[model samples]
Target: MIEQFFPELKRYAEDFVASYGYTAIFLISFTESIIQPIPPYPFIVSAPFFKLNVYMAGIVALLGNLLGALAAYYSASFLGETFVKRLLGEKLYLKGESLFNKYGFFAVLIGEPYKLVCWLSGIFKMPPLVFLIASFIARSIRIGAFVFFGNFLEKFIS
Candidate 1:
């Protein structure tokens, strides 16, 4: 489905990962976490196909994702609750608020994909160091899985 809609993007991701190596993975990971719709999974998964070192790729990607997440976190922090409330509206914002209030740190760690969790964490003013730690752990696991699957796919094909 993605290929059908965005063949050029797919090709660009492939070519970028192939040519730029870990740097590509880092940049993609960063962009994806911040605002880009394309996830970094494809880049991580295709690293082996490009004959790039999967471990390095994963680490660099993790770093990028952390940086991006931090950017999101800080951006939301700067924007404050009024902006988020206006953006999300009353009902949705309340739901997010309820979840974050209940789950706290785990909300950010577990719901990394939601992206809103990161923003909400900042909006609610979760401690910066705590947010960083939880985000790092979550992103590490996620990136590891993508790298593992990429290597697994490579070996399967070979």
Candidate 2:
């Protein structure tokens, strides 16, 4: 579906990962967690194509995402709700706020649009340690699933 817009993205991601290795993975994942619109799955799946270790790629991606989430969290915390609402737009901010209000920590744990949840967590003053632990677990499971899926694809193709 994304290829309809970015026809060369897959190829570009493959080449980028091949050339830059884990650094490429980290940067891709980092920007994705913030506002890049592109998901890191393609770059992560390309790891095996470049003979990079998928597990390590997943770890690097997880770390990058965690850092990016933290950056967003802190930015929202420091910038205040009005600024965050402007940044995220009123509709999205309201939706995120509703989810945070209703689900609390579970919103961060289970929300699909994680960036919003991360920002809401900070804006709502979720405990830092709690946020960290939840994000770590959620991101690990998410990245681990992608890594294993990539491994499966690699083996299937081989």
Candidate 3:
């Protein structure tokens, strides 16, 4: 089912990244980390084909994602736990709490488990410096993976 959308998404990502370069990749990565539905994978993977330097693409993506994660963290902190409980429902919220409590730092280190961890970090009032460092490292590594993939693809195709 997800495969059907790939071609169109690929085309759009290629065009946008080609036209805007690092700015487009940064924006996509930033928004995706916050609430945007379009993952930045397409942009990262298509970056080489779009004539962007792979290293620059990864750096831009990492910075954007870190900033966006910071935004979400601050927003959640401002909103507080009561708001989240209401938003996610009692059961879901509790489950998230449990997962975050168990996973701790690893939650942010790995992206898939990060949404709840990001929210809980704020709700629980984790130290900002800690959040920033962990988030930056994890996001950098994640985007680096994409950059490597693009490099590999570019080499293979050439």
Which candidate wins on TM-score?
2
- Cα lDDT tens digits, model 3, 38-65, are 6677677767778877778888888888
lDDT of each: 0.81, 0.82, 0.75
* Model 1 segments more than 4 A misplaced: 1-8, 86-91, 112-114
For model 2, what is the alpha-carbon lDDT of residue 53? 80
lDDT of 1: 0.81
lDDT of 2 by residue, 1-158 (tens): 76788768756866777899999889877877676656677666667787888888898999999998888889889999999899889998888878888988888889877777778888999998888888998889888889988888788878
Off by over 4 Å in 3: 1-15, 86-89, 111-113
Separate clash counts for every candidate: 0, 0, 0
Q: After superposition, how far is residue 132 of candidate 1 from its true place, in Å?
A: 1.1
Taking the tens digit of each residue's C-alpha lDDT, what string does model 1 give over 1-158? 66888889878887888888888888888877766666777777877788876777888988898888888788888988888787667887798889888999898788745467777888889999998898888888888998899878878877
Q: Worst 10-residue stretch by lDDT in candidate 1?
A: 111-120
For residue 115, give model 3's deviation from the true position in Å: 3.6
Residue 111 shift from truth in candidate 2, angstroms: 0.9
Stretches > 4 Å off in candidate 2: 6-12
